[model samples]
Target: MDNLALIESFGDFKDEKGISKIDLMAIIEDSLKTLLRKRYDSDDHFDVIVNPDKGDFQIFLNKMIVEDEMSEDDDLEIELSEAKKIDESFEVGEEYTQEILVSQLGRRSVLTLKQILSTKLQEYNNAALYDEFHDKIGEIVVGEVHHIRNKHVILLDDEGNEFILPKENQIPSDYFKKGESIRSIVESVDFHGSKPQIILSRTSPVFLEKLLELEIPEIQDGTIILKKVVRIPGEKAKIAVDAYDDRIDPVGACVGVKGSRIHGVVRELKNENIDVIQWSKNPEIMVKRALGNVTVNKIEINEETKYALVYTPVEEISRVIGKQGQNIRLATWLSGYEIDVYREKREDDDVNIDEFRDEIEDWVIDEFKKVGLLTARSIVDKDTDVLAKLVDLEDETIDDVKQILKAELDI
Candidate 1:
């Protein structure tokens, strides 16, 4: 191939499947640069020279000028006679270029080059993917539902690239229709081989926050700050917001006049229920607000461990915990605290509790207190055998505690 043909081949470096030539050349250059960098530990010192005339690619490695060809193993050293071959006026201490053919590479050398190229290209693609989605992390991207696999909804972007929306990432009430356009946040971007894979989500609390930011001008303008969000996907979400500007009510701004702003967001989210509450710095208040629609009688918070003991009416326990403990789980995640629910002991239930009066109550209570279990409610919730092991109690004492707990707590 002539020089022009060789350069044109690089320019037309497309695969038979119609991949871009420039992209292929970039992949090749990236591959070569990685290999040379690792082998020489200097990426900038090597120049890749592609000669179309000789159908060869040469790596012009610049070595330091050395005096006297004393080291026989130095391939960089050129004897005065050998130096004269390329240039008759060649000096003893000058760097030179040696032409090498790609075709002359052995099987092992070829394999090494292939591996280096593949690895570098993958790394480059991953970095590119991260850069592409990092700026768009809070923004929504529209995609078409393509197919379903292993309970995950596969979606296609505008470029026809496929992305996996895992089952856990999808909103509960939102059913995806084939070829239907769905909106979601670019939760994350990962690189696999030569392409980028985007992770999409609708159930993330961040999705609701982003939607509010999109709909509410006050939030986008920094007058209102979204502090925390606890969500049960399509079922319900509780958002805690604060007002940076005293004149603006954060909750009022999110609700909009006649509830327009939040309604728009709710509509987009398939009419998922939302409760906007004023954010409080107090851990007790924050935990109470996180358990939305549930009336909390009292809350005791431990600042050191970030745990809360919450007491609620017996009827509200299921509502606070939600189906499959989703509400409590989301509340804990959003509030950054562990919450244990308890109901107050009733006076009428004391008759049943009196049956186990004499059996090891003081010993179990002392052991429980030593191990940080300060409440009778916390002790009654534990499994008798595990609690016995934790407190180093005899099996007979554990059995007595279990009966007492079963009678008192109705467990």
Candidate 2:
């Protein structure tokens, strides 16, 4: 075999596969040692060198220069006369080396070298992929869709690496179209089989957070900070935000002047309902805002258990519960609390219900008219539990409302 052509081919392979030249050299040296041991049957120590500037490949065996003409161990020593015959620079008791050309390693080694190179290349490729994506977990990636089959998509990123988007990781409102652009977050990177696999997801909460950062400049610049985010796939999502600069209204800025900013993120999410609420240190106040489309009259919390009792009006119960509890579920997830919702009932007071207009949830007053219930004074004397069913609330809420009315009527 022509050693020059082999070396040139390996150089080109190293460049194309992103394999380090030094690593290839190590593999070559290892392969040469194995070949020499198998073919020459000598356990003598030697060093392999691939100095392309000097020669394609060479193997040098170190030997001690002895004054005697013959040595007891022929492989480990060379007589001074014999060493001088190979290289004029030879001295007794000095080290001498004999070089063997790579071509001389011979035709029998060709198959083994090929197998070894193939295995080494695969190992290097896996290493390169792992290094490329280990820190990219949870990062947003933009790629072009290359192929789609059985609801799974193949995408090629800017680096020319292909990524698979499985059906389960995709949002229900989204579909992969060939040759279209898609954006997703890196869910995980794994080495399962022969190669490293990068798993991508469109339904992940990080994807939504990234989309917000992309669309809203304020969020990206830290003017509006995203505190927490939760998603129910294509159905609903809620994100809590805080204002680093008090001048910025976190929710209003995210929502834009006329819902323009949030609209961009909503479009990208395929119109998934997004509720950008303000984050509060008080879990009770935060849970109240997390109810999305529903308004909570009051929130009571059990901090140790991370549980909350949220009271909304009976008229808004359907909105609070949402479609199959999705609204409340996302609210609970965003607030970091397990919330139990209760309908709020107002206690009858000597003063008219209209007197505390700003203090009560609007839905409660609407329900009063719907049920033909009269003034607050009428239900004041009624039993708390029975009045709860009449007003669609819990007894605890009714008692709390009575206390509130008494306080207000203290005049």
Candidate 3:
């Protein structure tokens, strides 16, 4: 069983691939046992063992020594007279071990074992790759852009692992060039085929969180805490942060001097707007702050519905809504509420428009306010037919609703 060369050869090969000796030996021994049973007798009992120092293995057959000198089956049954030549102490009808050599194992069996070991090594390497990167999900990695496909960029990470940066995960404003550096968060890891699949992203909210952790030393050291972050990807994001120490301003820290700290993140995001909001336990205050520069005169909330009605000045409406509602969209995501920003308006007759919130449909309420019909008196005093046409309601529908308002107003 002195197979030092065989073991040394495998050891050298596996060492280069970072495979452990125990794992390789298990694969080799298992393959040999399968080969031995397949090519030999199905009833054969055997055990395989490898000498660690010599790097050699032996296949020993457990067979009985019978006194039947006429028995022709030497593979499983050995005659006592013949067995005595090898061992003088051998007894009749007793089981003994026979060491089979590699030559006796046959060329076909050895070749099959080689193929099995090769396949097992590939599987081992794939599993090793998976184990190495599975914990890196959500962490940032620096990579060099190796190649760009139709919808993905192949990046070689710092550890020399190839990660897939799909177009969907990347910001729309980002462009890829070969040999350029790429920084992104690890979104996922999978051993799809021969290699581990690492998916990277630059647009995920987690990426923004990582960037904040990177740019702000206080956040990393825990002086400042990021309560929550939500992004609309390439357009805008809202991040709620708070300072544990009153002396330290979390919002100011994140914004940096002259917009320096935030500028790093903004440049990385292709100039995407990031509103570092002062996190508040009160949902009303948080919702108002999430609107960024928009000044909120008042905030009304329905806790059960998680809906916020924000009243800002008429000039601040566009800022609250942002371009194409992106600001409001991200604000809603960050504040955990459905926010509807409104401008405060009073009827010329000093009518209370807030009372009509329940009377008219939510959509038509804005049109009525826009037309200066800010009160029940305004709606009821106006011609009901003309109101139906103006608000796109049927005459009966308008009359039925307005009658209730008229009776309440005692008109």
Report the C-alpha lDDT of model 3 over 311-371, residue by residue, as the tens digit: 8765466577777678889889888999986656444332344444445566666766777
Question: Where is the poorest 10-residue window by lDDT in model 3?
Answer: 345-354
Stretches off by above 4 angstroms in model 1 are: 12-127, 134-139, 193-195, 293-297, 311-333, 341-411
What TM-score would every model get versus the actual structure?
0.60, 0.73, 0.77
Whole-model lDDT per candidate:
0.70, 0.78, 0.80
State the TM-score for model 2. 0.73
- True lDDT of residue 16, candidate 1: 31
Q: Single out the weakest 10-residue window by summed lDDT for candidate 2.
A: 347-356
All candidates: CA RMSD (Å): 10.7, 9.2, 6.9
Q: Candidate 3: where is the Cα deviation over 4 Å?
A: 34-44, 51-56, 66-81, 88-93, 346-411
| Best of the two (1, 2) by TM-score | 2
Query: Can you list the residue pairs that collide in candidate 2?
Result: 348-376, 349-376
Order the numbered candidates by lDDT, best leading. 3, 2, 1
Question: In candidate 1, which residue pairs clash?
Answer: none
* Off by more than 4 A, model 2: 1-4, 18-27, 30-44, 50-57, 62-96, 345-411
